[model samples]
Target: MASKKKRVKLKSLSQGRPPTLKPLHSLSSKATRTLISSHHTLQKLRAKAVAEGDEAKADAIAKEIEERGGIEKYQHASLLGQSSDRGGDSSRILMDWLVPIVPALKQHASDGRQMRMLEIGALSTTNACSNSRLFEMERIDLNSQAAGIKQQDFMTRPLPNDTKDKFDIISLSLVLNYVPDAIGRGEMLLRTLEFLKIPHHLDSGCQEIFPSLYLVLPAPCITNSRYLDESKLEMIMDSLGYIMVKKKLSNKLVYYLWRRVSFSTKRTCFKKVEIRSGKDRNNFSIVLK
Candidate 1:
């Protein structure tokens, strides 16, 4: 019998909201080993608790499992079964999620400006395009279980104080699923906006776009959630002043690309927009007014 994978939705949020998420706590290495070994028993206990009408007990068990960096985190740990190098491979699934923006990366390299990338919930695995020659990647995970990964809580952390130290790309691959609800997911997106590097200055001839977000999630999350699909996602993000550049749905996962549009460009956004599929990319491109 096959086990079911969890479903998660990608939320669109306004920048004004605040994240009230709880802290993520990682178990010690020994504790993690014990947890992994006792996973079945824990599940059984959780099930019994649920059956006994002890909702509080069930929730506590579930939160403990999640905070200890559950199955997903174990699969990503540096010292675990799979090596992180495999995750760094460019041939991995959806490797070209950044393909359309390769030209921009090349241009930045030519200008001696390295594109900065932030990978949230990267755990011990390499982030999407971490192997790319285009950017210098920095990772943050709620758990310090993995060495060399910074400990940062994305839900509540304030934006960096230095203006010159913003990232050009932020990847939240498979991370938003951890959020509990639509509002929490929306709040996470709101927090994400602070780290984006949008250009304040706009030229009449051509407005320069800023940092873009790369989001990947379980395919079901997109299909099942009313507000998280390609069309609705673009609409939601548009309201928040970002334009959806591309969206792709693969067999196991979904991908989204969003470029930060300037305030001036946003003024013209809702006028007349068209969604047309890309010729060979199997994704849709949005033409904003």
Candidate 2:
């Protein structure tokens, strides 16, 4: 009668581990209670819909997750959790981090396909390039939801083998600000260009021609501006062997079209060239030749 005894498995708490069991507290604040209630309600509804095979309701909930800024907010929360103090301006933060590394990207670009392009942090660059007849566009982003985007961590992951020598233009539009590390952001650009040249044969095949680059940053002269300083940015590009082919400002945005001067051929002349002569002689040249 007094025969059987059952064994219960217990979890171990080691020297470094915190205790697993604790008394539950009713100390949750109003916001915590509301969040718990909402989460439970959502779980119940989702479970009901799934059980009934209500595809439409499930789809609506999915859309609501996106429309309510859930994804962006989640990404932000993750960044904050990692101890980043960059604050709300993710785009500007990424730009500041990336501006210093533009030169390396210009040097390593490869030309195997009709155009080799690597768009950094851009979902809109592809849309913009759709309007341009000159260059084929390739959109690259860390965000998985970006349309036609290749999902890869530009900072850590190597570029895909298939993308080598596949692009002609590399555009980084409002991307660098989101990354917390400045060097990693720069390295991402370099890695992207390196990835683009990997598939091509070096000599007889295509020499992996460096592609032209377009960098858009925030303007410095304007107060509370998120844009990069044009003069300083051009200096950085110049050091990297990229010459400023075009400069334009729209609202808070500053765009610079740069091409590697060493790669310049007679066939690829700039649309506008500025020439300054000696004393009492300053001229603006519009390149027609």
Candidate 3:
């Protein structure tokens, strides 16, 4: 009789051995984007597998992630892209837009209190807005890389109770795309409102400055997604009472400044129905529940 085949068991994501991290340096722009995008895709697949209770598939994905050098390596690659030599700081463009449109940000506020900014998913303390004297910034990230950045999940942060706890502006650069699912992305967007200062009456330019969101996303999310486009994004923001103040689209990224126009309680249901169809379009979407 043939010997019985030995069974092979796989470890779950938590039980899997940690990946061997290698030092990442000088990652080209294309390579950095590829790594980030690949990680996102794998994460989405793993989320689906876990949700469907496919233990074996989840474990396989976990192994694949390990082989790819895990989250630490992915983050290191991202840091390379953000280096000054790459001109990868999204806030530089944000500063350019603000100086001409909202001159108040170029100088200290009249009350002697600098504008408060909450930078979610902050990777560096040396970025344009962080270095500027115009804003007192509180930077938070899921994985803090340095001393000043607090390691915190934005989703779990406590809601601001009073005006002092709120912020004048919130930056979510390249963050929404990192959310593993569509509904979570929408929730993150809604949560930004809870931490923002109340819409105060002021000059048009100044009003546009405070209680705003400086959003940066990969250009393909808007241009190549089957369920999202510029119009769709605008509609979603409008439902949340935010009006677009400025928008700039580049080859690889898209930037938007949205100011809260009103505290509208009206809700809009945006499902993940495909709004556009084309060959090679991505499935990126935001679902408002």
Each candidate: RMSD: 11.3, 20.6, 5.7
Q: lDDT scores for all predictions?
A: 0.54, 0.40, 0.79
The parts of candidate 3 lying over 4 Å away from their true place are 1-23, 101-103, 106-110
Per-residue error at 202 for model 1, in Å? Answer: 11
Per-residue CA lDDT of model 1 for 1-289, tens digit only, reads: 9444343322221111121223234445565445434543454455445445566766787776666555454433323422343233212333465565567667767888767778776655453456566777778866554676786677756668875667776788766654433445555665666787765542231133346777776575556543344666667576666787667676656777777775332322332122332333222122223
Best candidate according to TM-score: 3
**Clashes within 3 Å, all models in order:** 0, 18, 0
lDDT per residue as tens, model 2, 1-289: 6433332211110110111222222223443334323432443344344344565665565455444333343333333322323222323332343344434333333332334456665444324344332334555555544566676555544446565444545666544333322233343334434443322343331232344466654443212322223443454455445667656665645566665544222232222222322353322111212
TM-scores across all candidates? 0.59, 0.42, 0.87
**Arranged by lDDT, best first:** 3, 1, 2
Best by lDDT: 3
| Candidate 2 lDDT score relative to the true structure | 0.40
144-192: candidate 3 lDDT, tens digit per residue? 7778899788887888879999998999998888776787788889888
